[model samples]
Target: MWRIFSFPLSQIHPAVLALQLHLPNKHMVRFREDDIMSNIVDRERDKRTMLTAFFLKNKADETKPKYLYKDFPKHYTWNGATRTWTPRILKPQRGRIVSANPAEGERYYLRLLLSNVKGPTSFEDLCTVNGVTYATFRKAALEIGLIENDDSLSQCLTEASLFQFPNALRRLFATIMIFCEPGDIRKLWNEHFNAMSEDHQLYCQSVERVQNMVLTDIRAILQSMGKNLTDFDLPNLTEEDLQYGIHREVQEEYGIVVEAEDLCAKDELNSDQKLIFDEIMTHVDNDRPGVFFIDGPGGTGKTFLYKALLAQVRSRGLIALATASSGAAANNMPGGRTAHSRFKIPICVDNNSVCNIKKQSGTAELIRSSKLIIWDEASMAKRQAIEAVDRTLQDIIGVTLPFGGKIMVMGGDFRQVLPVIKRGTRAQIVDSSLRMSPLWSITKKMRLTINMRALNDPWYCGFLLRVGDGTEQSIEGSYIRIPDNMTIPCTDRQNSITELINAVFPSLQNNVHSSDYIISRAILTTKNDSVDEINDKMIDMFQGEEKVYYSFDEAEDDHHNYYPTEFLNSLTVSGLPPHKLRLKIGCPIILLRNIDPSHGLCNGTRLICRGFQRNVIDAEIVVGQHTGKRVFLPRIPLCLSEDDMFPFKLKRKQFPIRLSFAMTINKAQGQTIPNVGVFLPDSVFSHGQLYVALSRGISRKNTKVLVHPAKDFKQPGVYTSNVVYREVLLDG
Candidate 1:
């Protein structure tokens, strides 16, 4: 380099480097004067992009295409003219926290240890405790309390055995043994043997025969997971009781029972619902790749129609995946799961993205095998998530067709919250929704007009439509008038939060234990600060002794510990529980994460706190299909996503829950609250927020608005900002 500098310092052209310019060695970049390589790559990419965009935009020209798609580079490539590596691919960085499932065996233990341990060099370091090292990763994880014992496994069974049949319990036991990585299999079987073998015990005369039947059933379940009973610590099946195993679909279609009521739902569908039900059913019946979107507002029987369609397909022994964008909506239907959990959609997505589901994995098989997929609240999901599914299906099924030629039935109202873009504008939010997706043009559109909740009051229904459509006359910059019946004036003695809570949860002290009273009522606000203010005061007024749970927070990969404990604890984020979560024994709370959607533990799920322990929280599902079901929640290690606007990844280990007395408007989508109180400390900021908050209630009598203007408390009457991106409501 010195010899070249001495020979011709100013004469040599900057773009003289060969392919070695990409090497990160001691040599400086050759093209220092200008980014000639980048410019070359950009020009090439623009040309290729324009050629394709031109063809797509002007297909009517009927001219022969000059360039094929394969001519473009897939990723960074070598440019012959510039003699530098060209960046051709716009690779999308998918922000997803990769957590190991219990079924992954050693890797799961390692992940568990990693969540707690720091600065480990090798597997031996993780397995080592003091001077001695454990034989297995499981022993190591248990040694340091990184992974708890079989309590979760036992509770899972205890919860399942309440309504599940004996055979199902045994199957669950087998699944737990195989996938859950339970430390003591023999102990679990011994504890639940009676329930697992109850059916066989009734018929079999001898005790040995019942035990043998139970073990035989478990053996069959174990075989389905590609494991033998001998792999576990359970007793060997009796030769006489040993039998064949039945195959199960990856998505568990066989696990669902076709009840008489579910079957009768098809016949009871309303005329509007029947039309959608018939169209989707026909496509499934004929084995066609049909894409349909059922457009409807809240309380318009969308969930009712979804259930009917799911039952129809499941009744025919076909696999129907019922998924929703929000967990609240998912919990309303039978065999429902959140769309993200079902599809493995990336947490942070971009234009170029794909589903994280592996081709050989069970999830892939489920997608390929499923005859129907009903994605509820589709309007709320990001266009990239929808596109990711399309790309994944096309790749995995080896069929270039949309969604791998599967029938995808998505239903939602565009009037509600659209796809959330972090700090996104109106245009950004609208552009992120399915309305802008390429698939929207080809997808069949259906509408549901009859408002089942407000059908009696046509005026109220019309008013809601006007609010959502942004058609209501504005008082001041999108501020709309609140119906006098629904407005609650804030007074000096009674604060807005207290008044709002009182309206929603009447006789709170008396009805603390009543799930019906709590589940049907909630206070909706436009911001988290307002929600927190309401929750703090409400919890203080609540009867039971306050239970304060503090989160363990730290910045991951910060070896120097630049972020201190105090700073970490103070960081509050959306969709994450606060640093200090205070609760009472009977106070209703909402899940901040999807712990187990199948068991009614999901984000936005309402629960009544039954008991509290140092390591776990005992709660009861107070809403949706699993009402009154008890569940255990452990302190899980959760990290804020890459999109949380933090330089370093923030990890917080805490129970995924928050006080549900008040929640933001976005979280209230798809829920039917009988009594809702909207608190507006300021005007609603985002699109459809005002409409969603106001429309959550069943009627105006139960719905109340507590508007506390920041500067002007003396406004003529209660009036808050109603943000509606009317362009999104357009059919186009």
Candidate 2:
């Protein structure tokens, strides 16, 4: 953020007019780091530190110019005789490279050795001692007395096995083998083989077959990492095992279980949905290409249509890809994944950007072979992201048409949350939306007017349309007055949130372990701060002992420098969980990052804490297609986006989850909570935030509001702002 106030340059820094002449050939002088500043001969009377005999530093003055210079730091001199400040440059201390996470393992220790030992030109030079080279950085560090042991390697694997899947574990093992040389590879394998082969054993039901399958998988993993099993003291793979099919994409697709209920979902589609299903199925049956879009408001059965389409394609033993803009929405469908993960779309995209998918890659093959591609919540994605997918698909399928002339069906509600642009203007946000994409003009558009979720509450459905359309009656300018019956009388902050908790999660103490009871409700707020406040309050009020897990936070580039551990712990950033996570048994928690979404771990995925251990949280999925799935979540390092306010990258090592008694309005998007309580101590900030929050429930009776506006309330009831950018919004 640039300063709003500015002053003349002359006043900000010293003038360069009084710089003295220097003779570099005459002599050389040097001083200790402390002596230069502590010695009186090199110091000034006004507490200015002398960078050198010929240079001055205003280190005590924050208003003075400060530059992060690697060498020849610019310094200024206060010329007492001329009553002016002169500038000079002098060499200063240098810093070493570091990473964000302290527990990054062997490479972390190598970085430490490099920081201190110095002067090593090559990898061999760093590990050489007495004219002999060590095998690894771990050995060198041990010899140099930098550390005691490489025990963290075993500990890391043990912790990971408790949470990660067999495939993720194999990849991690391969990474460890490449980077770190463990003391006993055989011992490591013998101990963790159960975890690495758990699934194979379950399926094969024979010790020999399971071991062979596991070895084959590991062999394949090693080849991908440019290594072989022979490199380590591990068991060798058979000649047959050395050869694995290149049909990984085909295997994963066929593994998608198609239930009879999903197959029957097609028969239940409404008249409007049937038109879209038939139109898209016609192209699929004929082996033709087309792009189609299903536009609708919230609860118009977009997910229902997606299930019917997926079922139609998959039941016939064909491939169908289900993707959504957000992980929460993606979890709602069968075999759904976020578009970014599925397409390998770059996080930071531009007009010239294409997906990271290569023609020979498994993801590329998946896209090429899939019969139908269904992208839900398309409006929330950036145009560039969609464009990248289109370009990559065209290139992969060897076609000159949009999405490589593939059968594409996208769906979204334009009145809901659009693409989130950091510090963006109204025009920029609208321009970044999918509606602004060139493909939007060519795609066949379909609309669903029936609000299936609100079918029983037609009055509530009409009210939501008004909120979405910005045609609702306003009490104070753009601020809308919520119906009194739908709002809790705001007496105080504590009381209001307490009332909301009762309304949303009633009998919390009695029904803590009941997944069905807690899974159906949520409380929404506009800000992260408010979400934290309400969650903390809810956890404290609940009938259980809270367990706190603290994160190890670090700054990667050291641009922000080594912030104290205590200070780093106090930070809370968007899209990341808090540094100190407070969780309890049976309390609702939401995944902050997308970890194994196919197993139902993703952002906005709600889970119930079954148990808590030192390194992992034992939890059960309470929502979405993978309900009742008990899984373990290990402490993983999470970093902030590039647009973070910090000077450098901030990484925190903790479970990628947050308490979900209350969640932000943005996180609450693409979700339907049976009972919702909107807490509004602060008004909605961005466009469509108010409309999205109010329309999260099936009926007005189940949805309640708790508004204690920061501004003084003068006359009658609670009122909050309804921000609707009508220009980009479509009416039903």
Alpha-carbon RMSD, candidate 1: 20.1
Work out how many backbone clashes candidate 2 has: 0
Q: Residue-wise lDDT of candidate 1 within 1-732, one digit each (tens)?
A: 222122221222222221111233413333334445567445444442322232332343335332222232333344556444344566522211233335545544544554444334344655787677987767876766444444766766666666546765665576456434577888888888887877887788888877777776666556444467788887775565322332334535657776677788888878998898888888887898989999988888998888888888888888899899999999988888888887888888889988887888767777777899999999999999999989999998999888889999999998888888888877888889898999998899999989999987888899998998888877657777888888888775256566777777888889877777877888998888878888898888888887766676668787764664545766778877897889888888999876556667778898898876545567788888888777656566677665448888887877789999888999999998988998887877888888899899988888898887644534676677788887877463
For each candidate in the order shown, give its overall lDDT on alpha carbons: 0.73, 0.74
Which prediction has the highest TM-score against the true structure? 2
Per-residue lDDT of model 2, residues 205-303, tens digit only: 877777777777766566444357788888865446332765555666778998788789889989998998899999999999999989988899889
Residue pairs of candidate 1 with colliding backbone atoms: none
State candidate 2's TM-score.
Answer: 0.74
**TM agreement with the true structure for every prediction:** 0.69, 0.74
Model 1 lDDT, full chain set: 0.73
Model 1 scores a TM of 0.69
